[model samples]
Target: MDFLNKLKDITTFVFDVDGVLTDGSVFVSEETGEQTRAFNIKDGYALQLAVKLGYNVCAISGSRSKSAIHRLNSLGITEVFIGARDKTEKFKVYLEERHLKATNVLYMGDDIPDLGVIQMAGLPVCPADAAEEIKAVCEYVSPIPGGRGCARDVIEKVLKVQGKWMNAEAYSW
Candidate 1:
């Protein structure tokens, strides 16, 4: 309920890829030398739901991968930014491009690389298994861990508060 109030005004969600989206472990294909990441299907669904509800969802990560791009694109997220070293700067650019204010942003991250952007966001969030430093700065730490349903936890809270969760329109498929 507390988190719901904090997320009530959020219009955008920015996420860090490594520890927040994945389990912070990369599965490198020895045969093809391609990096693979495991993502949560529930998280993916929530992302699409956010987009369907007209909220901007973005991905900013230092590592780049083709599969990640394809996955996010499949969910209709066009603001995916992989190979991003300066997430805060990238986030600022996104805000300017969309004519949005920093105060309307929610950022979820889980490590040192994500600290700057997490601080810049109005509502900073982290997964349950996030680093101690990262968790310390978060406004809310999801009960679920990364690569699980962490994103779903937060998104559902916000949507439910706004009377969107479980609504017929929200479940439109």
Candidate 2:
């Protein structure tokens, strides 16, 4: 149950967007016929930190958004699944394609839609603001709330546990 021990086992990170990345708010604007969502900058920095540490990162979500794709692309995350109603199934396929085992994957989610994949990952995480059921099932819970640096907290914990935190560029001279 030690944080570092969990990080030693993680090789990949899978994320759920609405609640995990954004603040779980869906803004629909009738005037411009556009849907808008807000993402947490701190959480995004954490994801980037994971990538910098060489962890493979991917996003899996039931909702599709051009904005989400653009943001992820900007972050240099290329593996993404949108409008996936059955996340577990997609996760299986993705793992096979990447030649990664389930035990090497870590997942972060905040809702029922993410339950299946969360249960399937080697390490499952939930933000402090996550649903009760998700919190109960997750292997770890971030101290920070979603859209408030929760992702960064998780990533930092994982890296620290794995002994990679001090090796990150930001920590170097």
Candidate 3:
């Protein structure tokens, strides 16, 4: 199948948090021992828009950073899974709960941990700086690196192909 055809069938967006959402950099506060991650505003916009447009958006991560979870929640992604020890299992549960097929899901992951889930997705993608092993399996690799609009790049493409991007809903938020 063609790339556009794959995008057309995608009803859900599953992304890995650390390297996929942030730059894979963690800032640990020496005083409080708190770890935080940075997210791209453009990516946030795309995520919220996907939610508003009725697409299922989820974030899964092996990292247990509260700040990362908080950031994803703030963007209206309620299906956030932090501290996922077995991402493949989590992905299966998410699919079963939602009654969704793997062929209709877009999974973007950035590392070894995400390999299992990424392989199950219909359209697997990764950021430019993703591990070489990860890049090898992905059907699409964003030119933009992690935490630098990579999420936006894929989301925008899918939305645009589905005739959902830049509509009246996009103007407001």
Candidate 4:
């Protein structure tokens, strides 16, 4: 099996929210000091499809934004973990509790804070605009930057290899 073959082995996809789901920008209101991040619709759709297909889709972020959580939860990700300082802990727990092997996981992240969790994934991935150190360590790096279609890039590759990309099941919903 080749590197691409490894993608077909993935049963779960875990993502970091800040830089992975967004462009790593924080929009804060000066009056109320409220922070918000933009999410990519393509990424959201692919994630929801993954969940609907019975793949474990999860989000782990250090951020505690109500809107972000609401959006991800709306997409059917029940394993969303916000305010996770040590994201690797959540990674391990998800695997253990699900009886999933490390090789069955694909984890995407984009910064120093996500480095440890990335290390724990069988298919460690990063966005094109990720930190240099993170890109250097990732097994696969998307050409698209975060908050764009990085999540879709990985999801497409996996689904295509697994004979599920753009299938009738994907269009049913």
Candidate 5:
């Protein structure tokens, strides 16, 4: 399949945080007013493994949630772009800075704001619960929903295709 072929060349993984990672829900603290979002542990493991395997993993979000940023940082993702007004511009800069190519990137998004990068990425994917328009543009749509194992599903597929899954590195972490 075209999607499977694209996965073979994926050197980078770009995800939109709010919907693609957090299920599009935000909980505000009563006293501090700090926002929090829950992320799937399985997804976290896949992300960490991808990072360990030398894949370029990045999170671009329109939200300014500190907790979300912290979670990603703990996963060893150094390229976290929070509060990005225009995701397309940030994505371009990211690729240019790393000397990476668009055809080697797999971008997962769940909404309209993610349209630009999704259109440009070599492989565009979405979760089952993604917006209809976003799903329409995506090359693949995982059956898993966000804040679930959607990330894990896609990441596992890519790693498996590239023979990066089920290796010693994956066994350890």
Candidate 6:
């Protein structure tokens, strides 16, 4: 499928946290109760672009981390789900609450937990570092690795396809 054509079906964007947002690393300091995670600046910029383009952005994860919340909040993202073991079920609920159809969503994931949601969405995306099984089923795979601008690349592809990239000013920062 052509990359741009896929964007016509997307209205919502869903992301996985661990591998998709962070580098799949957990840094925990027992002494200081501090945890740190690395995020891709390009990915953040892409998300800002999606928001400016009027797409609903959300993050879904089975892990609950304060760091995740802080990072997403800083980006002006409000739809976040933590500790969600059944992502597909949660996604259904999210669709119902938002009054959106399954065919209007784009889901990006890198692991097994993400499989269900990816299968259900209209457009399924995976990062370069995604597992082989995930890559096989995804509609698109980014050239960039996860947590290293993969998300941004996918967002840019979508925007470009939808003919909305030129109007997205939020990414100017």
lDDT of each: 0.86, 0.83, 0.93, 0.89, 0.93, 0.85
In candidate 6, what are the lDDT values of residues 58-151, reduced to their tens digit?
9999988878888887777889899898999999999999999878788899988899998998889989999998999998888878899888
RMSD values, in order shown = 1.6, 2.1, 0.7, 1.2, 0.9, 1.7
1 versus 3: better TM-score goes to: 3
Clashing pairs in 5: none
| Cand. 6 Cα-lDDT | 0.85
Per-residue accuracy of model 4 over 2-115 as CA lDDT, tens digit each? 669899899989999988889988899999999988999999889989998889888998888777888898998888899887888878887889899888889999999888
What is the C-alpha lDDT profile of model 1 across 1-173, one tens digit per residue? 35667778888888888888787889988898999999999998898899888888999988887778988888888888988888878888988998988778889999988889888888999999999999999899999999898888888878877777876656754
Q: Which 10-residue window of candidate 2 scores lowest in summed lDDT?
A: 164-173
Candidate 4 least-lDDT 10 residues: 164-173
Answer with 1 or 2, whichever has the higher TM-score.
Answer: 1
lDDT of 2 at 91: 94
TM-score, ranked from best to worst: 3, 5, 4, 1, 6, 2
Candidate 1: list runs displaced more than 4 Å: none
Error of model 1, residue 62, in angstroms: 0.9
- Per-residue lDDT tens digits of candidate 5, residues 111-163? 99999999999999999999999999999999999879899999999999999
- RMSD from true fold, candidate 3: 0.7
Report the Cα lDDT for candidate 1: 0.86
TM-score for all models, in order of appearance: 0.95, 0.91, 0.98, 0.95, 0.98, 0.92
Error of 6 at 156 (Å): 0.4
Query: Which regions in candidate 4 have their CA more than 4 angstroms from the true location?
Result: none
